[model samples]
Target: MDESYYKYHLFFCVNTRSDGGPCCGDSSAPQLRDYAKQRIGELGDAIPGNVRVNTAGCMNRCAEGPVLVIYPEAVWYRYQNRADIDEIITEHLCNGRPVSRLRI
Candidate 1:
């Protein structure tokens, strides 16, 4: 496995359920994931390998809906809006410091 492709891999759970089950999609996970991607792109040449932001199906943690997990460090976070995403990027991706307030 060529793990060097990206320094960090972020998986955002954007699962949607028509059965009215608790899901990340209900909390705007896709939109926030896009916001996070844009923010990472804005970093330009500041970081290491690419910080990949991807959408994922049910992570089986709907109770912690709107969740995202970061690789290498394997940190899990539950976010609500763009601000939270910004903090995650600035604190975690940029500074090598995970945002404790957002961690799940």
Candidate 2:
């Protein structure tokens, strides 16, 4: 099969629910997603391929809130702050090792 365009594709669930239910948006998924995107851009060639970070609608794991999935490995994680995001980038994105503590 042809190689994937990006070595890693991160999809952050930024869906917002108006029914007073838990959602990724309510957990600052968008802001966190933006931060991850910026961090990836800053890494440049340190990571393989063109790492793409995208916003996704309701990954159906709202109960997990602020969830993100990294493709090529399909590792899923739940993050709460910049530190969590940084760890994922540093340990997973840049180093090819998934952050076990944050994995969901």
Candidate 3:
């Protein structure tokens, strides 16, 4: 297989369940997405180039809401706060190691 264009593609699920169902948005995923983006930007060359972070819709795992999935490995994770985001960025995106504790 050809090399990936991006080293890592991280998708933060930000789906909002209007029916009061569990969702990543219920845990402030949108804001966390923004935080990850801003933090990645701030890290600059500290983080490898070609790592993409984005917000996604329902991943059909709302029961495990506040989740993110990282590709090309397709590792899914559940996170709570900024610290978790930082750990994901540092351990996964920066160092090529997925944060096992956060994995769902």
Alpha-carbon lDDT, every model: 0.89, 0.90, 0.89
Backbone clash tally for model 2? 0
Q: Best candidate per lDDT, number?
A: 2
For candidate 2, write residues 1-104 as lDDT tens digits: 69988889999999999998999998778889899988888989887678999889999988987899999899999999999999999999888999999899
lDDT agreement of model 3 with the native: 0.89
Question: What tens digits encode model 1's per-residue C-alpha lDDT throughout 1-104?
Answer: 95678889999999999999899998889889988888789887776668899899999989987899999899999999899998888889888899999898
| Most accurate candidate by TM-score | 2
RMSD of 1: 1.5
Misplaced by over 4 Å in model 2 are none
Question: What TM-score, computed on C-alpha atoms, does each candidate reach?
Answer: 0.92, 0.95, 0.92
- Provide the clashing-pair count of each candidate structure: 0, 0, 0
Pick the winner on lDDT between candidates 1 and 2.
2
In model 2, where is the ten-residue run with the lowest total lDDT? 46-55
Residue 99's lDDT within candidate 2 is 98
lDDT of 3 by residue, 1-104 (tens): 78888888889899897899888888889999999999998998888868788888899999987999999899999998999999999998889898889998
Residue 9 displacement in candidate 1 (angstroms): 0.3
lDDT of 1 at 89: 88
lDDT of 2 at 14: 95
RMSD per candidate (Å) reads 1.5, 1.0, 1.4
